[model samples]
Target: MSRILVVDDERNVLTSFQHLLGKKGHEVLTAKSGEQALSLLGSNSPDLILMDIRMAGLSGLETFRQAKAIVPKVPVIMMTAYGTTDTAIEAMKLGAFEYTLKPFDIPKLTALIERALAMGQLMRTPVTYGAADADARAQRIIGKSSKMIEVYKLIGQVAPSNVTVLIRGESGTGKELVARAIYHHSQRAERPFIAVNCAAIPETLLESELFGYEKGAFTGAVARKPGKFEQASGGTILLDEVGDMSPSTQAKVLRVLQEGTCERLGGHETIRVDVRLLAATNQDLEALIRDRRFREDLYYRLHVVTITVPSLRERKEDIPLLAEYFLKRYSRELQKSGMRLSPEALERLSAYEWPGNVRELENCIKQAMVLGQGDVLMPEHLRLGQSSAVQLRSAPESLNAVRELARQHLEQAPGSAHQHLIEQVEAQLILEALMQTQGNLAQAAKLLGITRPTLREKISKYRIQRRVHLNQREG
Candidate 1:
């Protein structure tokens, strides 16, 4: 459960929030004024702070600054019965999670509170490579394989430095966990660690989401908002699936790397950002660059240091260990005791190739925990279904593999060496993605790290000999 601190000068506001948030399973601590909130911070580092902007004494802005100094990672959401656009913008620039006019819409307020709590938890949660600590809350990497050990070592070596890191791995290979581990062990451990799923966010809003926006920036943009970079200043920001970013977003991100500044959409003023940027991707960036999809400069900037996580198939020896860890974790979470994986179940888990990697294993275990009865979880409980296991796509080719192919292509046609390399690699990558997705254009596009139109254009540009139906949307 999350602990929330609600601060307001009015007694009714404090009591209402305390009672309402309490009903939602959050431990709500309320204070009458900014001074009281600051005092509360002395002893408690709440996951989220909800404060009124117009508090008596201290003031909400001052309290927010002080609260950040006290617990730098905690997220604060400011509310005011008397809110102006300037006040909201100021609060956001000061690193408030959100700013809202008071007389709260209960549902919207509750949703906002949940989001802040989730963001705060993501920032502060510990990521370990070994067994769970005494407190079961720590997320463990759950492998002793040499591959994983190397990954752990890389995380350690790179965590202390301020270099931008590129984590390469298949989807669900625990890249986010690696990013979190780096953050937790780094010098900026006390500061926030914001994780943005670049692939999940739509291309249109990705820029505004990263650099925020000015009021009247768009039709619906009623007020100015500060972006995650601002909120994570002096901290770290992990851009998950950074490969899927659009060219415009990529250019903006490159600017942030070259110069520590970004301008919000429809705004003239440049905002300086101080963040340790970490990017993770499953895409073959070399191929993306070849296809002219991913920016070459941005790729170079991100790949200053690279950590490649082993896919589950590559580290099959860790299957039993990971399965057991998940069993215990889900047992505790689901409140089911004496739940053990059967010998047959262990054999089954070990035999099957995990296409989705660690995340799929965790989900499989959690599902089994809910399905299996008595003490032992049987093989049948696993239901290691045919669909995922049957579609055994090859791992993404390494940059070295691409370079080797480039050498062969250059030897063949020195006059158009680069073009030959791009054609061969892009065509091959597109074919593989199409075959993997059974010729579904959308999925192929996603797998190829480009848009559907771009993918269609490449299909024609390469004049791929293998014809596939383009109309099918689902793969």
Candidate 2:
């Protein structure tokens, strides 16, 4: 049994933690605020501290800094109710033992506690790459598929270091999620996690957004701003969609990454920043690098730790659990109590091809939940495009034919410019998801969490109408 400290401003939460740990046969301590928690840590230090991020006086992050001063070896687990991208990332950067969202699974938490204790026991042993303090991982990525298992093993090997990580995969393959998982599992899991999407902001403003600007640096620069890098000092920064960044901006990014510092767009001071870099992209960066679009040096820097997320279709076995997860999430979001997927609906979803990946899958379920009139989701309510019945039947049953069919499906149909761009993105996502899922719809949807009807809609919407035929050997 390990001694645990539960810190929170809310009395109910503190009590809940005490009860949970006590029931698990562990000695537990409770603190109402950061000040109280530190005082308790003066002489009696618990093996682990589970602290709430938001509090009345000194915040959890502040308390974490102080507690580590007393016992540098003791691990801290940060919990947050508000699942903001920045906060979650920040906690992970700060060397937190783990970052658990509110309303987390009890069983998962129990397992995590055991792992932490196990890791504590193993600390005396020399830690190494792919084998360092594996028990300290914030979240256990549970998967048995060859690809997913490889990803886990790789992360365990790299998580404790300060290496720059580049996560590549199709959109909805959880590239950023994988980066966050890495941050939390690393030695810097207790610092800050700051992320910026390179594609969302306009090109003209991206430079200022990343390097920050002085109060009057630009016409609309009313107040001095700190960039993501500055905010993420002593932690990690996830440069998402790195492939979309402009050449000019990419050069600047490369400089900061290589030199470990940056100067604001108009500022003179070369402010130094110590941060671990994590980059993600759905585009073919190697091609971009070859074309001189992305800097080769920067590419190599971020490539220090490369991870590819498995598409949903690739892991068919995880679909049922994923479906259940999304159903519960959508149910709570829509205020529909005890909503579920019917057995037939589940079976149908398992049969369809999800081109949109996980993001599309979640959207389909949300739309279905809203359109659904009952507690259960139905095939019709999903609005997925399943107009590929003809194409599927006509497909040839050869390896070469399957690849050719997939390729033809991605080839653009005749369309106007606006439709063409949408079609292009849609085609790309579908193809990538299919590749990752290994041509399995159930796994793809679960990977994407889309209903059969909805994924069917996109396949038709993009006119991915190439026919395919598979032998008994094909999955």
Candidate 3:
């Protein structure tokens, strides 16, 4: 049975429809005003909304408009006792699924509701609904950080034009997110946004992937195929990891950018594609150009609108919000209730250096959510420091302080070296993990997913032996 929400100011009409729909085996909810309906919507999304045309406070038409704003795809059937041509026309114009005059045929209304439900199910999936806020409809950027705000501004400024965008960032820093943000917010938002990773594909296949190929283009070419450019005509194409692309492919890409035209491999016909190109690279493209690995002309072409995504370390302030967001997101999926991070745990997270950036932070949070025993997440829930057998020994004011401590101890020690750089970092990580695990090394190693010996090597390397001896002597 489909879920339906009925909104009307009349108690009698609401009772009659609720009884009728309930007996027909459909689950029904009732709301007297738009505010109540909105509250209901926040909890659960109904398949269809059956609204009376006139109501008190907020009119049915205004309610319907608000409903569309919240959940654009839900089908709404407007009902009115006093039917007029203008009302019907206005309802249709505003995308109402159907219009019914009050005291009307109940059977016809039921059929229309069923049809609207079926149509809604076929048109869009709920997962795709409200994927982001309404403001993000034009851009897929999911951030409120100052860095991302600047990225959003750049998107708005360059979206209307056919400017090539070069997005630079560290690996897993969400370069593609920025690229998608640009594509979805641009004039080509309605069109397909195709992304091709330059490094993943083989050199030979990269050309054929960007430009179409004739049936006889190469020995393996059995049928004609369209390239990324052709498929993205009048749309946007993202060349991800562009710095890793082969020099030969770089030359081909340069031609497409300069001429807006390409010839299929082994095909004489020249095809033109009006595609806006967006390129992304973690590597410095200028350095690649200087090394003769990337074409300078191509670099200039793709750098028309540059957007640089800051590493997670640069925006540590966003960690708490991002952690909460992911906590809620994964908690809902896992059906776990009352999940939240402790302030201490969040502080520990914010102090660390996220080498892997957002991707690493997301993974850490996901792991923590799975390990958390109660509503609140503690430092032990995260296995970050344990990954490399490194145990951070101090709660420093900054990442730089931690690094400085590690360097000072390494450089100033006059005895047999206490630890190598890697060993110290690893020992620090392991110590933090052990503290979180309540001194359970086996579980800590398991959390780190390493054999006890490897963990032991890190412990011995860090010269924690003297500390253990001192504890034994004191005991």
Clash number by candidate, in order: 0, 36, 15
Cα-based lDDT at residue 354, candidate 2: 61
The collision pairs in model 1 are none
Question: Scored by Cα lDDT, where does model 2 land?
Answer: 0.69
lDDT of 2 by residue, 1-475 (tens): 5799989999998888888887665789999999999999997878888888888999888888888787655667777774442453355445565666687688788777775665443332222222323454222343456787788787777788898888988776667667777776788765656567899988999988788777578897644556767756787788899999998888878887778878887789888889888899989998998898888877887798789987767776655655665676555435666878888777777776665555556666765665467787777766554322233334466556656545565574433545555566667777655555555554444435444445566666666545321111212
Which stretches of candidate 2 lie above 4 Å from their native place?
A: 1-143, 333-337, 373-376, 385-475
Query: lDDT tens string, model 1, 127-235?
Result: 8875445346787888889998899889889999999999999988999999999999899998778889999999999989998888789988867788888877788
**Leading candidate by lDDT:** 1
Give the per-residue lDDT of model 3 (tens digit) for 1-475. Answer: 6789999888898899888887655789999987788889988899899888777888777788788777765778888774453464365445566667777787688788877886555333211111344432132334677886786777678877889989899886878767766665567665546678888988878989788677678997755556768766777788999998888788878888999888878888878778899999889888877888888888888897798988988888778867876776666545456788888898889998987777777768866865578888898888775432122333345556767877687677745345455566677777765665555545455456554555666666676544432111100
Query: Candidates 2 and 3: which is better by TM-score?
Result: 3
Score residue 39 of candidate 2 by CA lDDT.
Answer: 97
TM values, all candidates: 0.78, 0.53, 0.55
Best of the two (1, 3) by lDDT: 1
How far off is residue 171 in model 1, in Å?
1.3
Q: What is the full ranking by TM-score, best candidate first?
A: 1, 3, 2
Which prediction has the highest TM-score against the true structure? 1
